[model samples]
Target: MDINTICVHGSAHKTDYTGSVTVPIYQTATFAHLGVGQSTGYDYSRLQNPTREQLENVVAALEHGTDAIAFSTGMAAISAVMELFEAGDHIVISDDLYGGSHRLFHHISEKNGLTFTAVNTTDLLLIEKNIQPQSKAIFIETPSNPMMQITDIAEVAKIAKAHRLLLIVDNTFLSPYFQNPIDLGADIVMHSGTKYLGGHNDTLAGFAVTASNELSEKLRFIFKTVGACLSPFDSYLLIRGIKTLSIRMERQQENALKLAGWLAQHPKIKAVYYAGLPTHHGYEISKRQARGFGSMISFETDSEQTAHQVLERVKLILFAESLGGVETLITYPMLQTHADIPASEREAKGINERLLRLSVGLEASDDIIADLEQALR
Candidate 1:
């Protein structure tokens, strides 16, 4: 089946008794066993819920991995994956990281003895130079948040293999609809299903899919121990949301290309970062690696004042934090998303006060542009 067909019917397991179209949400804390030591494949909700398992099964199939695990949030999934390392272990990471990830690696994991080094992952040499003797893994976010940086997943995966390091790619920006990192030699693929996979921004969810059974077992052990798995009801919601993913993403990317082109031509705009644009450095590589350029766009204005004016005046695109919904959203990364990083560091990454990120939604392109034109005026 094609990806669109897989998105809908891939994980539809045998619905023996009910024959229901949707996977029935097994909303229960515990399931009854027929006899001593007998089980119905599910023993407890925390360990595994039927509804959540349905989601995991589908996602695993979608990502072309051995297995998948679902969590309450994307961070929880990441946190569990981090458990693969010991206290003294080190990891190489993308310099343009999401603020929450930056926070977790430093404030939470570093305090516990794990260390990380962030580098410009687009350059393979930078990654090679940064790998410490203790390095156990390389965590990456291609077309990274706010900045839209792309990394050659296959190249990074090769480096990981040479160093006996695990390669973990955050596929949140593109979702599996646009990109599948595991297919490119990555050991693991992670997603904040809260963003694209959930589609409506109504649910908070995360997932990790492992390319090998060995890694899957390790992650499953951590997942069972963490007790931060996704709820059964939310699992159902994510499943429904994924069914329309290809269509929603098609529209969203269409809007993003139009908007990015317009921004590049705008006199008030200083820079635009979008992989779809031919001017972007990673445009060709992104084309070779993924199915489409994602809907996320980041651009800079001539001044901070001008950026704020647009943010304040936009009547159609809501000034918001999260993305990947049906409605358009505009985010101020310097403040809302990347504020946790040091001021100097953010400025160096081009996430300065003049930068604004747009998450184009299902709104008509003309209406969205009209709002932006009015706001810019």
Candidate 2:
């Protein structure tokens, strides 16, 4: 079936109860046993839930994966995957990553004995040089966090395969509608379903889908044991959010392109980082890999004070930490999202205080552009 059809009806079928067109929320925490040692498909909410199962299957099918596991938050899903690595194992990651991801790898994972090296994965040579003998996996976020940097998934996958390393790609920015990393040979594809997958700020969820059954089984075990499963109520909201993902993303992409173009021409703007822009370093690769350029955009202002001024002045866009919702959001990565990282390190990576990131929404492009124009003024 086409992606559009799958979006609306992939994992759900007309149920006998009320014959509702929409999938009804299965709110029970546990299911009763049919007989002694016999049971229904769901034993407990943490292990499984009908509503969450529908969401899992939908994401799995959408991403072309063998199976999918949903989590309470994006960080939880990431932690579960990282747990597969042993104490001595090393991880190679993109330098421009989500702030929370950096914290998890540099602080939390380090405490657990898992070492990591942050490198520019856009350059395969840099990645190859940094791979240690004990390196177990490579974690990457293409069109990375605030930088809009892109890495060739197929190229990285080839290098990972040669080194017998697992390849995990965070598909949050592009979402399943724009990019399917599994199709490009990535072993695992992950998303902060709180963002694009949920399509609203109402719920928080995360998910991981694996192309191979072996990897799926391993992740499933970790997820079940760790108990980071998403709740049934949020699962219902996520599924509903996904139904209009294509439409919402279309508007968002349109708005983002227009905004990036405008920012690039602005006098106060030093640089605009967006895959949609012709001059963006990642434009070609993003064009080749993704169905669209995506809604996230970032720009460097003349000064930190100016950046904050622009954010404060924008009336239509909310100044918030999260992204990929129907309403636009603006954030300072240096302070809001990546604040956990050391100042020197963040500055070195160009996550400066003068940088502003925007998650464009489904609002009118003209209104968004006008609001930004006045804010910049």
Candidate 3:
């Protein structure tokens, strides 16, 4: 089936006794068993819920994974994956990743005895050189947060296989409509479903989609044990959001391409980091691995003063954190998203005060650009 059809009807499970088109939210803490031993496959909400299961199934289908585990937020999903590694295990990860992920691995995971080596995953040699004898997995976020650096998934997967390590790809930026890391040899795919998968800023959700049953089983055990599963209502919200994923992604990318092009030509804008732009460093790699460049655009302004001016002055384009929604948001990553990182390190990655990240929404391109035009002036 086409991705559009899948997005709309993928969650239609066999247990849908109701004639309604949408998946009904099984809003319950526990389900009564047919008998003491017999079960309806869902005994508890924490272990599983009908609605969340439907969500998991649809996401699994989209990512071409064996199964997907939904969580309260993207961070929860990542935390569950971290539990898969034992003490003394090391992981190779992308350097320019989300601040929250960096904080978790550095503060929490390291405390638990796991170590991480952060490198620019875009360069295969940099990744390979940093791998340690204790390395158990390689984690990467292609089109990494704020910076928008693209890593070749197929090439990275080959490196992981050669080293006998697991390959985990964070597919939050591009979403399944644009990229399927599993198809490119990722052992596991991660999503902060709070972003594109939800398609709206109203709800929070996350997912860990596994390529094999073994990984699915492992993550499921950790997920249920941690008890951070998504609520039935949020699952329904995500389901509703995902129904329009195809159309929203299409329109959002359309708007992003236009905005990126305009920003590149503007004198106040120093550089535009959007894969859709042929001049972007990651253009060819993104083109080969993903269907579209996605709706994220990060641009550097002429100075910190200009960056602040645009944030304060834009009317239609909101000055806010978070992305992958129906409303265009312009965020200052240095203070908002990646603030936890040390000053020197954050600035080194180009997420300084002069940088702004834009989450292009499903709006008329002219209106968004016009708002920026007025703001820049």
lDDT of 2 at 24: 76
Best by lDDT: 3
Q: Compose the digit string of candidate 2's lDDT tens values, residues 49-143.
A: 88888899999989999999999999999999998899999999999999999988888999999999999999999999999999999999998
| Per-residue C-alpha lDDT of model 1 across residues 196-264, encoded as one tens digit per residue | 999998999999999999998998888889799999999999999999999999999999999999999
Worst 10 residues of 1 by lDDT: 10-19
Off by over 4 Å in 3: none
lDDT of each residue in 106-126, candidate 3, tens digit only:
999999999999998999999
Cα lDDT for residue 160, model 1?
99
Residue 61 of model 2, lDDT score: 87
TM-score each candidate: 0.99, 0.98, 0.99
Worst 10 residues of 2 by lDDT: 10-19
Whichever of 2 and 3 has more TM-score, that candidate is 3
Model 3, residue 237: displacement in angstroms?
Answer: 0.5
* Each model's lDDT: 0.93, 0.91, 0.94
lDDT value, residue 174 of candidate 3: 97
Model 3 scores a C-alpha lDDT of 0.94
Q: What's the ranking of the predictions by lDDT, best on top? A: 3, 1, 2
